[model samples]
Target: MIDVLPPWPLLGAFLLASLLLAVTPGPAVVYLLTRTLAQGRRAGLASVVGVALGNLGNAVGAAIGLAALFAVSSLAFTVVKYAGAAYLVYLGVQALRSAQAVPQQQAQTPPATMKTVFRDGFLVALLNPKTALFFAAFLPQFTSAAHSPLLQSATLGAVFVAVAATTDVFYVLMASLVAGRVRRMGRARLWGRYATAGAFIGLGAYTALSGSRGKA
Candidate 1:
């Protein structure tokens, strides 16, 4: 609600910070680019939607105190973090297997269904406990003490997600252009599959190993 928002100057600062954070190359950006280059624009766009939705969920979760739960309970954080990492590894393995199963002549066949792609993206983003923690930590900095903290947090989270989604869509469009060129080369197509798989697997490892006390 407008009443919960911080002053215009504070809101402007928050928007500026959100834009910078959204554009920074991070796990989400890598995921988007890999999906676009490997699967196509449709999958990439689906992934963007899925991720955006997942992020929105985290924002809501933060507003409702889920982040505090994770912050206090190491077990909860570890369980969720490992689960997410495992899922990423599973996706990577699936990509490799799918690539092998498809014959060279069938390369034109779609790598995965849009539903599957969307689900993968959603789960990947949702499972990252750090994302929830990030929202919990980040949104409070711009909140006004005189207003409802919960509403302000949720509103700012929504705004941040919107900015991130816009940047993600741009990344997809750029990656799609490169993918068009890669499609013309059979070897490049095969390599693209491997690269996608590697990216996912590597991200999984990174997530699993990263410190628990930090922003996503």
Candidate 2:
């Protein structure tokens, strides 16, 4: 992939941008926070694992040329985009409903089993086509056909996933800690739960409405 390598300055800039994008407040971060706050550290870690798997899957898809297929096909692109949009809206409504219910409920519940947690996290990531698009677009600026496109994309994707995973794990652990403390008090717990729900809804809306997109 060295043949198509961008100039060092451009490559460094792309990598930096990818790191920033990974940390920005978005569906993944919001989900991590909400899960951590609601379920605790173990469940939150499970979710993070699943999300990491999803990111790996996206990277693999990009490496293998599946992402290019979507990029070239407008119909396919629309289908994937709308599917992601629909899922986001569904998640938003669920969060809003849960927020409405949490105030009336008095006790916090135990988290799900690791299996169920993993399944939920996996499904959420698997269904999100936007992640693949991100890989497709983000990697190319650092690569070209002159290089081994697959390797370059894979390398960039792997770096991004590594940085992002580390950042998300930190979020998960911190959120879990704060949430555990907050849950001891009733009103604080209620507000925390509400805030988590609102974050989800806001992320969903942003994902659905935002026009800025990486090439698929």
Candidate 3:
């Protein structure tokens, strides 16, 4: 497997770039943080797993030339991108509605089940076609011409996903620690829910309005 990768220098550069990208806050990080604050550490971790799997699926799609299809077909990319954005907005709306329905006494408890949280996370990641495009555009930079392109791309994509998952886990842990304090204050908890909902809505709007180019 090592032989299929680029030279040591290029590999090191790739690792460094991946780490930097993983640490930078993105849609995934925002979603995880909100999930952690609203639910708990377990839900946040489950979301991480779901998102990782979804991202892995996108990486595989890139390896198999799905990203190439997206590159050439604007309609395909737009359709999937809008779908993901709409879902995020829907989640935000549902959160707001739920917040109003639940009594203040129960505001501290997580309203959604783990399965729902994981499924939402999975859908959020999977529906974003730009992720596959990103893998297609980014992975080839560190791949060697002498090796099988498929193997190199797949390996690099997996490595990037692993790095990203590690960072996401760290974010979840930190958010969980802070969540205890946030939950203690009734007004704060209510406001946290509103903030979470707003974040989701804002992220969705940004995703919908942002340029179509593959962004890290």
Candidate 4:
């Protein structure tokens, strides 16, 4: 049996952690699903691409000294992390309050242009400090100080992005399917807003609590 798996158990750790992380609800999924149900699949996919690019940036940061820099500088890391936490909370509060700005069953109206969608996606992911910290914490588990960690961590990050795209795309498709049928129902749209809002709140709370915790 030619040994194939890396001698590092941390690779498996990274994979498991990535899988769990992908399943967790975040702004990426919410943005994708909202765009899909509001605009269309193409727009949603563009958003996914932007998020994947952002994740790629995270991987690059890990490969270079960025993650290490943050790890070493507690003040910098804390600043970014808390800022991210506050942002998530702000999004949650906005979602909860969005009930008043727009009428129900209008999510499908004023479809988002592709350019707007991509720009929104890019900005959302780039400003998201949680994703940065996520890469910082998760990438190191799959590599070691003695080994060349850049390529390995980048590969792991790619895998994570692939999984996230698949997971979130599925969510968009499912939500879009439901949207087509439920758009006629005012109550259904309201439920979706409430659900998305609640997910945001839960994610924000989790991000705030989980700050700076290292797994594996």
Q: Model 3, residue 203: what's the lDDT?
A: 78
Model 4 Cα lDDT, one tens digit per residue, 1-216: 012224556556766777787888765787677767655678778888877777677667766766676767877666766665566566567766775567764654454478866766665665555566667676666565665677666666777888887887778777777666665666777666666567656656665577353421
The predicted structure with the larger TM-score, 2 or 4, is 2
The TM-scores of all predictions, comma-separated, are 0.96, 0.76, 0.94, 0.67
Q: After superposition, how far is residue 150 of candidate 2 from its true place, in Å?
A: 1.7
lDDT at 80 for candidate 2? 64
Model 4 error, position 195 (Å):
6.8
Candidate 2, residues 83-198, lDDT tens digits: the string is 65566566557655655665446446444578876765665675566788778877877776767888878877877787888888988978887877766777766566567657
lDDT of 3 by residue, 161-208 (tens): 999999999999999998878878878888877888898898799889
- lDDT for 97 in candidate 1 is 86
lDDT of 1 by residue, 56-162 (tens): 99899999999999999999999999999999999889888877887877788667889988998898889989989999999999997888888989999999999
- lDDT score for candidate 4 against the true structure: 0.67
Q: Which regions in candidate 3 have their CA more than 4 angstroms from the true location? A: 108-110, 214-216
- The Cα error of candidate 1 at residue 129, in Å, is 0.9
Question: Which is better, 3 or 4, measured by lDDT?
Answer: 3
The C-alpha lDDT values of all candidates are 0.89, 0.72, 0.88, 0.67
Which scores greater on TM-score, model 1 or model 2?
1
Better of 3 and 4 by TM-score: 3
